[model samples]
Target: MTTVTLPEKTPAHTGRTPGRPGRRGVQPLALNIVALAAGLGGWALLSLLGFEDLPGPAQVAARGGEMIADGTLLDDVAASLRRVFSGFALGTLLAIPVGFLMGWYGVARGLIEPYVQFFRTIPPLAVIPLAIVLLGIGETPKIFVIFLAAFLSSVVATYQGVIDVDKTLINAARVLGASDLTVFVKVVIPASAPFILVGMRIGLGSAWGTLVAAELIAAQEGLGFRMQQAQLYYDLSTIFVGLITIGLLGLAMDRLLLLAERRLTGWQERR
Candidate 1:
């Protein structure tokens, strides 16, 4: 009875770690809520401290209620949302292909990067006058300014992503007899997607700022226009309402993009 040898093996994953399933999520949200409350408290305190022109959260909420009652808030929200979406879509759609090309091809990069960098140095607001002159003081100007904002912010990010892709992966594809287009479509795009999403997020912020400037100078409606009108009469509550509305809108949009980024780039890991 030669009992040779017995081996004991340990399992890799024993059991679920308590409170480890997306635990990071709740803490940040809790912290954010705390921070928000503190910020509101501070603002209220300051308003009470002889800041006669400053409107606190309650005043802003009341103004918001009035705007909602009159339906101006709803109309302004819809109009601003439409402009942001349309312009952002147009800019991103164009930026992707152009960025991809510039990143992939040396000739394209050489020819296009100068113009891209030059135009990016010019503030989106700087182009408003030119856009207005050429496209007229209509939806076209507003949309064009937003488009420029998104385009400039995103292009560099897109190019950087493509450029930063692992050279080894590209070489491996080539060794496996993959064509240039096949390598780009199958490998490069997927690898660079995270960078593209970051670019898009930045572009979205730029779009909002540019849209507000355009609206302030020319438009008759939207949140920017509403704020401008409020400013005329020194209506602090209304001004506060407009500011908060813009902040909320931008934050919501950013969060939506962040969700999309997580879904789209699930292969990437975060700490």
Candidate 2:
């Protein structure tokens, strides 16, 4: 008998495990910090150059600090946050079901799509006058306008998401003995979740954008109201402070939605 030798087998590749992010995750955060620093540097450079009217980051920071000390900033923040949250919540709650109806049923789509499109064509700002005229110049008008902004954005996105879901998946679910409700709950909703979340994010941005105009209607205290007041005196520092505050608040809320999206859609693929 002849002696035989076998080659050694190589070990299996050990890649990064699921659910735990790798170095690529930290890279994005670092890049964001770098980009922010560069933006600030650019702003400072502009102020130093010929932009006498513009305030630098340091000046804005000092002005913001003064506002914080005066308790005005806190009140404004609270009021704006209340309106935004209330309006956004109400709009989204109503939008999801309406969007589902329009996308799922033919008759509902025919009746609803026309109005949705019509309202979408009209800017939420344009409704300010009507809102004030009808609802009165109070928190009602402000919240209503914000609700319109959020609702239009969210409903369109949701409707598109539902329509865009792969028809093959629905058919497969039905073939597998799934009922209409089960197919919608298990197949449609999960697939459409990303789109819905994206719509919500867009709606959030719309809400913030509409806020300044909404606050224009007999508003006393809000970031937007504060900015308008500062504008009369050309208080560049205070205006900058308000802008920065709104941007920061919106960024924080968007990040929260992004976190929710990632958690809910973890099974979805990423680049």
Candidate 3:
């Protein structure tokens, strides 16, 4: 009894460290902001060094404002956006069902794989002539070009995603009493969403480029048409303006897809 002793317990805060929530996140973002500012500053300096061909950000911004005021820019942007969305929607809608069929059905896969691969190798630009020949120089050919862009990319991605889905997961679903349709709907589709989205992003970019090519061939509207007009007049500034606008628009659309991807795939990190 006299020799009995108890060890002292440590206090909860004795050697504990405190953390600033989200502090790690802020630093990289701050560095990125600084880098962006420095890059813009360097661009401005370069523009001031007699680089007349290199349209400064300010010049592009001014031209953008002028175009907006004249209403042409907005109209072109809207028209281009509409074409992209419409074609993308049509392509993706078809691709999803077809991809699912090709992935799940052996006979369907054998039947469709060759055609899919054949068309996939053909460049969208190369197919422009074919599209025009088949559909004419109107919106049909243009949309078809965009549709091909989306279809090839999205379908391939969806097919690959479906094929690569974990067999274990499928087996687990089956063991849990999921019917084929239920398993596909509840598991396969959700699992393949990321790949499908990536395809959509690639497809959208392709569609934008294809839209420019499409507009180059007998079109009187859109940014590409405006740029062509500017080129004919030797208006380098206006051409640069249109080029920059196209880039900005593409960037905006890409960012929108990225945002959607982040939201849709939020659960990915937890895994």
Candidate 4:
């Protein structure tokens, strides 16, 4: 019997995969380019339409250059970032352990939750006046504001994440001869990492906002202080610059946290 002979291998495709490198890269770049173009075009149109007071990209760029020349802008940014980092670090360190203890032990939960819940309702901004009265209008008040902002947001998330850990996995660990502390360290922490990272991101954002609010009353250097000065002088361009810088910095921080989360909890994400 004669049989038809077929080729050993199938043909190599010429087309790219749906989300492969070529197609994916082009799509996002094209979209971003279009958006940038549209935004600049709108600014130009607004200027032409007699919005003289509203600063456009070029005006903001020029203002940024002027601020860099003066050297105040960098100093302001450094001050704000330092305050935020210190407060956020301290708050998260305190909150995470307390939150874990509360979530893990019934007695701890009963003892601490009432205070946590009560304080969570109080606005961070509302406490600034009280902080100033007690701590005075110094670095203490600003740091306290950021601490409150980070603690309140982080504790809730940490508490929830610990409680939400899978009971079955914990039991499995116990059956496999793991002690409570061992299981907690190995299984519970890994299980809850994503949630913890998510909480940290939220707390970081809150700290940034609180830094601005805290600086409002204070004497000295920060992006918020710069913005307040600009407002007093009615330098709209400078105000815009301060705001834009805050947004960009916040965005960068969030992206950094996202990268950390992806790196640390990569296994969970894969599943």
Candidate 5:
């Protein structure tokens, strides 16, 4: 008599590895917490070592708490947020169309590229004097400089994205009878989305970097202005507070953009 062996059944794959559902989400948050703790620890250590002009984490936190209780912090935050958002939005909105034009049309590129490159060489800070002279010492100048910063950052990124789109994909779309508009809408835009989002993120940073100078245009009631005032009185703690507030705000906004990028470019592969 012969003994017959039967094949064992295997589990079907569901395209995802078996693990705790929230583990991946929790990991990044945990790492971020650790990083924050490490930074605070280093800062505290440095302050303890008598680093002149450097306020410790505890001192800064206490000052921040007082500002928060007085509602001064909130007001400054609101003002700064308003300026950054307004300028950044306008810059990005205009940049997308202009960048698309420059990338998609040779004639448009010829006309616009020269000016774009010209402006790119000049720092937004350099424009401040002119902005104040022309737009006056008002909110207009502050917002204008910020707008220029964001516009330059975003336009360059957007133009690069458009040009960097895969030629093969465009050709294939064309061969499949897709019209130019259709190809642009269906193929080019999606392919270029990652770069555009990255550019927007860079633009956001540039806007914040320009904020201190932007608020210097004979204005008041913002973080940068607060920091400047603090500087006059040698209020290191307040200066630290303003610096930290701006950093936190920028970090939060950048994280939001990062989330948007992840959602929009879900089709792209990653490590």
Candidate 6:
């Protein structure tokens, strides 16, 4: 027993497993940090290399902090968010029924499809001047433009989703004596929901993009207005701040929609 026996050997790679949940979660966070650091480093280098007009990260941070302290940034953010939400809500609400009707009924499709195609071909930005003339250079025009952007983007997706539903499933439901309304409510709607949500995400992006052009018409207090004013003064830092804020806000909203999609579509099999 006292013969100098070595202890039992353990696996050398006995640390965290490669596919562990903790590692999976930490990887994205680590990568995000690294990416942010690299971007800031590159920005700083460029500014030091005599891009005199370009604002460094530090300069942008300082300007943003100043705006935050004076409550200007918050006001702009709130105003922009309000318009986006209101317009997005209006558009999505109206689009879902219109889309369902177009997809579900032949008469609805025949009447509406041509108009939808015509309007959708016209960019929301292109409609801004008309909107201003018709609705006035006020909140109504801006909201209307945003509404069109969201509505057009969503309606097509919703329509296609319904059209793409599994034909077999509908036949099965019919064989089971399901009524038209029952089949639509139980089969079509559930099948098309994912597409509808995807459309909403696209619509949200369109809404944000069109908001800038809409605000350009005559906004007094949104992020787009803030950036335009900064540009007039040649204030690069504020311009960067506004651009970054919009990017980050849009990213956050997109992620939320993705989260919703995952939750709603959990019934689908993973690869």
- Please say which candidate is ahead in lDDT: 1 or 2: 2
Report the C-alpha lDDT of model 4 over 80-194, residue by residue, as the tens digit: 8899888899888998998899888999999999999999999899999899999998899999989999998888888898999999999999999999999989987788788
What digit string (tens of lDDT, one per residue) describes model 2 on residues 1-271?
Answer: 9999876543333355555654455478799999999999999999888587688888889999999999999999999999998889989999999998988889999999999999999999999989988999889999999999999999999999899999999999999999999999998889989989999999999999999889999899999999999999999898888888889999999999999999999999997
Tens digits of per-residue lDDT for model 1 on 1-271?
8887766433335344544662334578788999999999999998888587687788889889999999999999999999998899899998988899899999999999999999998998898878878998879889988998999878989999999999999999999999999999999999999999999999999988877798955787899899888889989888788788888999999999999999999999885
TM-score of each: 0.90, 0.90, 0.85, 0.87, 0.89, 0.88
* Model 2 segments more than 4 A misplaced: 1-26
Error of 5 at 248 (Å): 0.7
Which pairs of residues collide in model 6?
Answer: none
Q: For candidate 6, lDDT tens digit of each residue in 1-271?
A: 5788777644435555445543435588799999999999999999988787688889899999999999999999999998998889899999999999999999999999999999998999999878878998879998988999999989999999999999999999999999999999999999998999999999999999988888987899999999999889999999999999999999999999999999988987764
Off by over 4 Å in 5: 1-26
Off by over 4 Å in 4: 1-37
Please state every model's RMSD to the true fold in angstroms: 3.8, 3.8, 4.4, 4.1, 3.8, 6.5
- Model 3 stretches astray by more than 4 angstroms: 1-32
Q: What is candidate 5's lDDT per residue for 1-271, written digit by digit as tens? A: 9999976543334344445342345588789899999998999999999988588999999999999999999999999999999999999999998999999889999999999999999999999988888999978999999999999999998899999999999999999999999999999889989989999999999999999999999977999999999999999999999998999899999999999999999999996
- lDDT tens digits, residues 1-271, model 3? 3897777644444443344332334587689789989988987888889676676779867877998999998898887777777888899889888888888888999999999999988888898888878888888888888888899998988888899889899999999999999999988988888988898898888888887887866887888888888888777667777777787788888899999998998877652
Native-structure RMSD, model 6: 6.5
Task: Order candidates by TM-score, high to low.
Answer: 2, 1, 5, 6, 4, 3
Candidate 1 clash pair list: none
lDDT of 3: 0.83
Which scores better on lDDT, 3 or 4?
4
Compared with the true structure, the alpha-carbon lDDT of candidate 1 equals: 0.89
On lDDT, the stronger of 4 and 6 is: 6
**lDDT scores for all predictions?**
0.89, 0.92, 0.83, 0.87, 0.92, 0.91
Residue 136, model 3: lDDT of 83
Q: Which sequence of candidate numbers ranks them by lDDT, best first? A: 5, 2, 6, 1, 4, 3
